[model samples]
Target: MTLRSRLPELDDATMSAEQRRVLDDILSGPRGNLDGPFLAWVHSPQLADHAQRLGAFCRYHTSLPLRLTELAILTTAAWWKSQAEWQIHAPIALKAGLSESVVEALREGRQPTFERSDEVIVHRLASVLYQHRRVDQATYDRAVEAFGEEAVVELVGVLGYYALVAMTLNVFEVRRGDEPLPFDEP
Candidate 1:
């Protein structure tokens, strides 16, 4: 697939003081660079600032563990078929201890064979939430039983935040390098 970003990256000279400040904060944060949706978000600095703060919390400070958080993010990326999101988070998920089989299954649009109960819980929560747009009682109960209420809430936040990331990447046609689309065309 040929993908080109609809939004141009903002250079320092064109950025307002606010935009520059936001960009500076992002550069210094865990993200360490303005890539992906941030390239489009820089066009609206205020929104970028707030969105980045929320994203930072969800990604860095959430109650859910990194493995669970990454799983939820990968689930969202796969559901959206968001190449940029998938490319960004897939390795992170692997490093965070997600199995290659699970990541590969997600990449290939297949149900993954999860070894851990926590992995299964997270995947189920994400899949149910993405597919149904809400968690049913059984899945909600299972998630709470596995992760507790606070972590469950944070899991949902991770899912929702990455959904926005996927949507932004999709809408703006952000491509992660020259990598081909990971999944078959719909």
Candidate 2:
């Protein structure tokens, strides 16, 4: 299926004070530009500010290791079949030390083979969370044992934040330029 953005980029000069303030903040932030959900969230400047801050924390400051965090993000992206999310984060995940094979398997919607126990926990946590909307007691115990309570909580935050981003991208039909669809449409 051909995809087009539901919300076009807003013209800066025409924006309200609140919108411009949020836009400027996003521009100066670590993200350095309005990518992913920011353009869409800009329509609601309050939401834009809050979501962008939360996104920065989830993507950058979370207690979880970058590789594990990216693993969870990719798992969430694949669960949502979000092409933009997949394209944006796949390389990041790879650079953070996730194997190309693992990224490819997640892209293919199959369980990836993980060498590390932490990787297995992260992928399982994300997968079970997406599938069941919550984890079972055993799953919870395993995650906490593997990553501790703080990282486990951050892992959930990463999964949830990326899932929200996936939904935004899906709802807005956001794409990374003229790239062809990554997943076959149903």
Candidate 3:
């Protein structure tokens, strides 16, 4: 079942007019909020609170730009073969200006596409971290060279966390409301 379709409706106190407006603003596109499960899943008060907090943290503190964070999110989702997660993030990825080549590379698991420094860095570092679990000195040095030690750490952390989120959402069957699988339903 899809997330919004599965989740029960919240109490009237759970969603304010302002909150609904914010949700509408964030969704602002086709099929983005076509179901209650998705609306409830995303609008759950706790998650909304956490998202607000996470946004502030990421905006102010992370070494990764929002685009870079989105890259890590979408790539990890693709790597995990989580269609729901991928569909959710694809527009965010494009909105961040990641080129078609980069998106294809993430889908195809092709790293270092076009040899641009950041793409190479994110792809390679994410790949090695995904594959190796622990970055060896060589990989670490290269990643640090590409985006400093802090970014490398944050990138891995973000990728790992998003991978976990993707798995949880899939395993728990928390799909966006009306978000049928782009491929077959897993």
Candidate 4:
């Protein structure tokens, strides 16, 4: 789908004082650009600030290992068929040690072959949560048992945050980057 962004990139000269402050803060942080959803979010400066903060925690401060975190993100992106999210997160998943085969399986909507028991548990939890909108007791128990309650909580937070991002990207018709679409659309 071709999408024209409803919100244009706000230049420093065009921004309100509040928008400029928020944009500058985001630029100085780990996310060094007002790219992706942030471009749209800048339309609502308060929401942009809060969402970016939450995104930072989900992306950086989470208790789950980076591999598991990226796995959850990829699963969320694939579930939503969010091209922008998939394009952004897939490389990060690989860089964080997720196997190419597993990333490909999730991208193609196939069951992945996970070498680690932890990967299996994380994938199960994320998939069940996304598909069913709630995880069954067994999956929740397995996640907690494997990763501990804290990490499980953080995993759920990641799922929720990414789901929001994926929905926003899909709704806004956010364009994908140079990377090709990861899966065939139905």
Candidate with maximal TM-score: 2
For each candidate in the order shown, give its overall lDDT on alpha carbons. Answer: 0.87, 0.87, 0.63, 0.85
lDDT by residue (1-186, candidate 1, tens digit) is 333588765777777999899989998998988766787787788989999999999999988888989999999999999888888899899999999999999998899999999999899888887788888999999999988999888888888888899999888888866896786655
lDDT of 3 by residue, 12-96 (tens): 5777765675566445733445232234335554564454444335433678876777787777777777666677777777787
Worst 10 residues of 1 by lDDT: 1-10
CA deviation > 4 Å runs, candidate 3: 1-9, 13-52, 55-61, 108-112, 179-186
lDDT of candidate model 4 versus the reference: 0.85
Candidate 1 local lDDT, residue 7: 78
Which lDDT tens digits does candidate 2 get at residues 1-186?
223479755786678899999999998999887778787888899999999999999999988889988999899889989888888889899999999999999999988899889999888888888888889999999999987999898888888899999999889888777886678765
Q: Can you give the lDDT of residue 158 in candidate 3?
A: 78
Greater-lDDT candidate between 2 and 3: 2
Output the lDDT of residue 110, model 2: 89
**Which stretches of model 4 miss by more than 4 angstroms?**
1-4, 176-179, 184-186
| Candidate 3 residue-wise lDDT at 8 | 50
Candidate 2 Cα misplacement greater than 4 A, ranges: 1-4
Cα TM-score of candidate 2: 0.95
